[model samples]
Every structure is written in C-alpha cells, then in structure tokens.
Target: MSPIKNPTTFFAYIRRAPFGGRLTQGQIDGVNAILDAWEYFKLTDHRWLANILAQVFHETGGRILPVRETFASTDKAAIANLEKAWKAGKLSSVKTPYWREGWFGRGQIQITHKANYLKLGQRLGVDLVKNPAKTLDPVIGARIAIVGMAEGLFTGKKLGDFFSHNTDDPVGARAIVNGSNKAKLIATYHKAFLDAIEAARGAVDAADALPEAAIADDVKPAESSTVMSLLGGTVGTAGMSALLGVNNPWGFGIAALVLLLGAGAGYMFLSGRWSVNRIKGHA
Candidate 1:
C-alpha cells in the first residue's frame, strides 16, 4: 500500500489547516511536489511524512506553495541584528549577493546566507550562488526542504532524531528545523497531519486487502478442528461461542466467515505481516 490512499482524500484531510484558510491550487501543487519528493528521496515513513508536512505547513502558515523568506520586507530588526553581528565580527560580514542582493532566505526551508546557498547549490548541482532565485521555485524548494530536513541539514537536527516507530516527539521535532521555535504550534499540526495520513494509510491497506479477503470468502473450511488448532484452544473457544450463536445455516455460515476473517487479521497483526514493506519496494 502506498503512503497515500488517494490524492483527493489526502487533500480533503489537508484542507483542515490550522489557520482555517482555503488552499489554493498552487498550494496543492506544492504539496504534491513535496510528497513526490518524499517518495523519490525515500522518506516514506508515515511518521516522517506527518512530521515533515507539519513543519512545512507551519513554516508557510497554511500557504500551499513553498515561499521565499521575506525577512527583508517584514523584519528589518532581524537583518539589522545580523548586520550588527557582522560588524562585531561574531559572524562573517562578507558582502555577497545574498547579503546585499536579495538572495537571502530563498528556499521553502529558508536556507540563508551566501555560503550556505553555495554549498547546497553545489550538492544539488544547481548554481544557487549565481542564480539564487532558483531556490524560490517550488520544485527546487521542496527538494531542498525535504532533503535538508530529513538529513538534519537544519542545525544538525535530522528527522531521525525525533521520529521513529517507538518514539515520536512532534514538538521536539521543531528542533529538526529550527531549535524549538514554534514547537508546540508545529506539534499541533503534526498530530493533525499524522491522524490524516494514518487514516489514508489504513484506507490504502484495506483496499489492497480486498482481493485476499475475497479469496478467503471462496474457501469454506471443513467441519474439522484445523482452524481451531491453528488459532489455539482459548481463541477457538471464544470463536466457537460466536459461531454457535446462530440457529440458521446461513447465519452460521456468516458467523464462521467472520471468525475466519478475525483469525486471519489477528494472525497477520501478531506476526507483523500486515504492514506493507514500503522500504524494500519503494526508492
């Protein structure tokens, strides 16, 4: 089963953005781009997907598309602070294009500074140092955001640091991108997205299991203890209680079918066989 059941269903879930605004077509496209990149980049873990999307949504403030950093127009105080740091020699005062030429904070994840841009550009085979405007492109921005976050490029706080099957700290996940800034807010979005994605995942798995279910329906077991033996005496006793309730043959048959399904699902769940092997099959 794929991480997403259907794009429509996924979009429907995404419409519940925290800020309570409608998503534009471009924003939807950007989301699709992000999902595609996740698959392409092999970050298909549902937990990771939920956390990543939450961070992205929080960063963009319900905007569908990845946007360039607007600190120049919106926050002169920050730029002045950076300038002050530069003057004090606490940070490099290199007057590159990104510093003076409006190339600063151009990616969805907002990779700032000329040196960082040059490094990321070299890694991705794009000349961000020369054409820093490319970071504003949604596709490029998605790639940068996806790869950067997953790999812990943002202040060495990788996605793996806070996400795993056994443990998930959505608020702490903010550390993966920006060191506890808006951690709780992003965590709220994370839980919402996680619920949506898990629902979609269950839907996809149920859909995929239909054929197997049909096959099970076709095979009616004999009047023997084989199923009971396989299911163990305790489980078989409980199943028999349900199976023996019906007086009519048709009702009995339906009850038996239900037991068979329950047994199959229980076995799969206990043996850890039900989940799709996404890592093995998908890149």
Candidate 2:
C-alpha cells in the first residue's frame, strides 16, 4: 500500500551501474507503474517479470523514448494518430521503424524480428507490423510485453538473445547495460520478478478475503437465509429429496451445517478482529 521506501532496494538487483547514476523521477514512476500493472494482471513471477524489465532497461537505457531524439513535427501527427487509434481500437495494422530497429527490440520488450512481433502481437490483439509504435507508449508497450511473457516469448531465450545485435561483442550486451557488473543486471531482473510475485500474492490474498467481507458488510444474515431458502425449496424437491435420502442424509445435513459455520467464520473474519492484531503486530 505504501511506496517502496528504499530507493537502493529498487535498483538492488541491477547487474551494472544503471546507464545513469539514478533513473529520472519520471522513469522511476513509469517503472513502478509498470510493475504494479504486472502484479495486477497476476503475471509477477520473479523469473518472468524481472527478465522482461531487465530486457527493457537494457534496451531503453531506462527511458521510455526509444532514443534521445524527439519526434519530428511531421512524425508528431502520425504519433498522435497512432495514439488515437490505440485508444479507439482502430488502426490494428501499423508498424513503425522504431518498432523494427530502434532501442531494445521493437514492440513490447522491443521485440525486433517481424516474425516474433507477429507471433507476440496475436496474443495482445495487435498487428505487430501495423502498429509498432504502440510498443513505444509506456502503458501499451508494457501491457503487450506482459502478455508476451505470459505466452512464453521469453522462455528458453538466453539473455544474449535480447542484446546480441546491440553490442559489438554479443556478450557485451550484459556488460554494456550492466556497466562493469553483469551480476547486477541479472539481479535487477531477479528483483523485478520478485517484486511482481510479492505484489500479485498480496493482491490475490486481498481478493480472496474480499468476498467474505463484502457479504458481511453489504448483505444481512436474513438476506442470505432468504436466498438459501429459495434455492433449497426449489432444488430440494422430490427427486432431490430422494437423492439426498439415498445418498447420505447425514452427509447433506453435515454439509449444510458446515456451510453455516463457514459463513459465520467468514463474518467474524471480516469483522476486523484479526485486523486489529495485524495492525498491532506491524506496529
């Protein structure tokens, strides 16, 4: 819920000196937002998310713009059109040079090869050839990448796969992005994945706990009884009654009893008894 407190922790896993001594505030915010979204989508496996982020970091130099160059005035209109089409769900077929040969690969994760783009785009509902710049936008690019990772684009690919073309010596990919420390780059990827996993786990636990809380807060016990009676009366008729009788009558009764107990337990759990203890424990 709170922001990550230590900035160094944020970069702890990076294998090299970040291209800059520190990422700009906008870059940090963008990265955090991307990480948060990955968690939200339940794609936060440390191995996956970290590798993806690391690749992006390696490609973009931790900046969102494909390179330092600003979009020319002529290109501005095209960029705007692309943004509009992206928002409106039109322009499904478009590809930009940037997506093909610019920073990183092209499209989400800067996937450069047209073949790879076509494959990955199918899962993201994009035509990689038609709308490549969509990968340039922080939100869309990251989302597409998360989906690509989910679809196993990165699986079995070595780190060199992402950086070979960028550096003179293919192995220099790690050294270039990581500066003097290749391990830091690997660690950064590892941490990214860990962050994604932890965030997703917290989200899932909260989600699992929510239905009980919502029912406890929004529905009266009487409302539940009314619904149960309606279902039981209709479904518990002759055939059902006979089935229940033939199967274990005791089993049916025990199931009902258990359901009631579980509901009560859920209500209690939502009533904030443990919440107080949780807060206290944290304190």
Off by over 4 Å in 1: 19-21, 71-98, 202-283
RMSD of each: 17.8, 17.6
Tens digits of per-residue lDDT for model 1, 1-283: 2487644345545555453434454565667777877777776678788887888887766664666554333334445655666778776545543445444565567888877788778767899888877887888888888888888776788888787777778888898888889999888888877766765564443332221111111223222232333334434767876654454434544666677788889999889988665566665
lDDT of 2: 0.45
lDDT per residue as tens, model 2, 40-120:
567423444555565566555466333222232334554454456556766455454442243224433555556666766
Error at 239, model 2, angstroms: 68
What local lDDT score does residue 150 receive in model 2, on the 0 to 100 scale? 51
lDDT of candidate 2 at residue 231, scale 0 to 100: 31
Model 1 TM-score, all chains together: 0.61
Using Cα atoms with residue i matched to residue i, what is each candidate's TM-score against the true structure? 0.61, 0.39
